[model samples]
Target chain A: MGMCPEHYIDYMHDYLDGDITREHEQELKKHMQSCVSCQKHMHELSDTVAFVKSATHIMAPPHFEANVMGRLPKRKNVLGIQKWLRRHPIIVAAAVFFLLMGATLMASYPNDNQFSVTTQPNLVVDGQTVIVPKGEVVKGDVVVKNGNLIIEGEVDGNVTVINGSYMASTAVVSGQIEEINETFDWLWYKIKKLANDAMALFE
Target chain B: MDALVNKRIKQVLKGDQNAYADIVNLYQHKLYQICYRMLGNKQEAEDIAQEAFIRAYINLHSYDQKRKFSTWIYRIATNLCIDRIRKKKPDYYLDAEVAGTDGLDMYSQIAADEQLPEEAVEQMELQDRIQYEISRLPDKYRSVIVLKYIEELSLQEISEILDMPLGTVKTRIHRGREALRKQLNNL
Candidate 1:
């Protein structure tokens, strides 16, 4: 029902390749009866196909056989057991069953988790004016090198500043803070870092 | 015969190494032709063809006996060619005159080369033109043209080689051939 007139392009293609089925050949002929542009296209396509087919005749290289022989793997001798298993249906079935069972068991088992950890160098604040915001926690190790740091929140870890002024405010601390001017023990350091970081935030 | 080929392959898998040489010898020429035509370089074609054989042998155990051996090997060759073609950028340089019949008008230069026989030289040149045009075609069509015309494989055989429906193979070959013809006409 949806059949439109077949184009000369299709006929040309089929004629060039000789792949046209009997039905299509008739359709092509019917279309060619009235269409001249496609017929010209078909003629050109056919001539072109003929021209190319006549021109190119590349041959394989001389050493093809030797090269192939060189690359082949040395055959391994077949063992009696492998041969026996190859022919034994029951053994093959059992082997397949066991292999699947082992795979299924492995898949069903939950794996134990081991702790994975990574450590980064402490944050360094240089002498440049650095601002720390209020009400934030500074956790883990932070190193400031030669910079001004303002902290106003909580620090749950270490804070080290080198040649840098640290502003601290009311904040919780669980770890130590060290600066060129002063060193605080773990609890004091944590509180100082947090306060400084929080204050720095506003500045 | 298909089963027999499969049995022979199985035998090769079972360490009958000599059986492999038989398979190679049987398929080598046809595979070589496909590769050579696809690559347009003899040395590369030889290498690709040989590799196809080696791969076929190594994977012999996985081969299904239901399919014809020729179809399987042809697939390998076609794939190898496609890989080679894909590695290159899309544009391919073509011999313009040979590609178009209009260039045949310039046959005067050929008449001057004394050492060449007239018919032989013309045939060689024409072959080169055809090959160039074929190579310039898109891979989908180029493969169909090569399989149908140069290899002279049936549409059914091409379908098997490509693992496509017979109707699809026929349509593609037709379309591809037409494209080649168009390209050549412009040449």
Candidate 2:
């Protein structure tokens, strides 16, 4: 039985699997009789295969699947949204900021156009000025300078007028409507007051 | 097709998060086995296996779709185990003398008994010894041998997983197993 090293090596796996052809098997058997080194190598290969094949499989732990599953993101619907947002963090952040701003503005001023303020008498107020209609009250010492103040009823607060003007009705001025129509501080204050009230509602 | 798996994985990378679970289910068991063999403890193996999967999931975009997904995951798990083994200096605590005498005796007794063929039993015992010897191998050889023999990956697969040329993978497997055989013969 004559065998080349290459053929024997090629057949080594088949020999171990017990699937060698008859002629090659005879050839290998005869070669192994005198080829001590090749025989030892063959034995080693067979032993290695046997050893590996005999390895006891340690089954993964009880929560093996669960542990891996837990590592996976929870199967919530929002994870998809989160993943999408994570992929585009910049865009999502911008969108969320604008969305929150719009919601805040809408909540802060439910109605867009009109604002009203009540006045008190006897104190010299600094800035209370708006375009008041024909019949409105000026109860305190009020001054109107800059803004258009529509003073329809009695002014209970001390009105100090500045740059803006106030169209006030003929009513009682206890102190003075001091400053008006100067900087539109009256309208700014009313808008600011509405914002503060909205914030208070949130709390 | 493997492309289908890669496509699913691409979906996972592209913000289809649920698609990740499918990839996990496909490879977790095989990864667990590798971790178990390398780490040799159930709890640690489980943790390492899960972490390996999660890491792979997070870095899935970096994986080349042309390669087998199994090979990719195996590489990650093996590298992690090797890193842990190195960081912990497994050799110091992994002294053969520290292994339980009872377990070794019981295994030897089984080998010496009549339940199986003498050759088969000796092979089994040698296999256990080989596994122990693997832990004693230097990191580079250790990884290649484990991936080739114990994990039963093809040479191409091992090379791909290791990101090495085929020649290097084959040489490492040969030398690693030879080292194990030498250690076993002495034992």
Which number leads on TM-score?
1
- Per-residue lDDT of model 2, residues B101-151, tens digit only: 743433342211113343543666544554555555677887776676677
- State the lDDT of candidate 1 residue by residue for B56-164, as single tens digits: 9877766777768899989988998889778644443333355556665433322221233445445656556555556667778878778877887888899888888
Candidate 2 chain A, run of 10 with poorest lDDT: A109-118
Single-chain TM-score of chain A, each candidate: 0.32, 0.32
TM, every model: 0.55, 0.52
What is the TM-score of candidate 1?
Answer: 0.55
Model 2: DockQ vs. true structure: 0.30
Q: What docking grade applies to model 1?
A: acceptable
Q: Report the TM-score of candidate 1, chain B only.
A: 0.76
Best by DockQ: 1
Write down the lDDT of every candidate, Cα atoms only.
Answer: 0.66, 0.63
Please give the lDDT score for candidate 1: 0.66
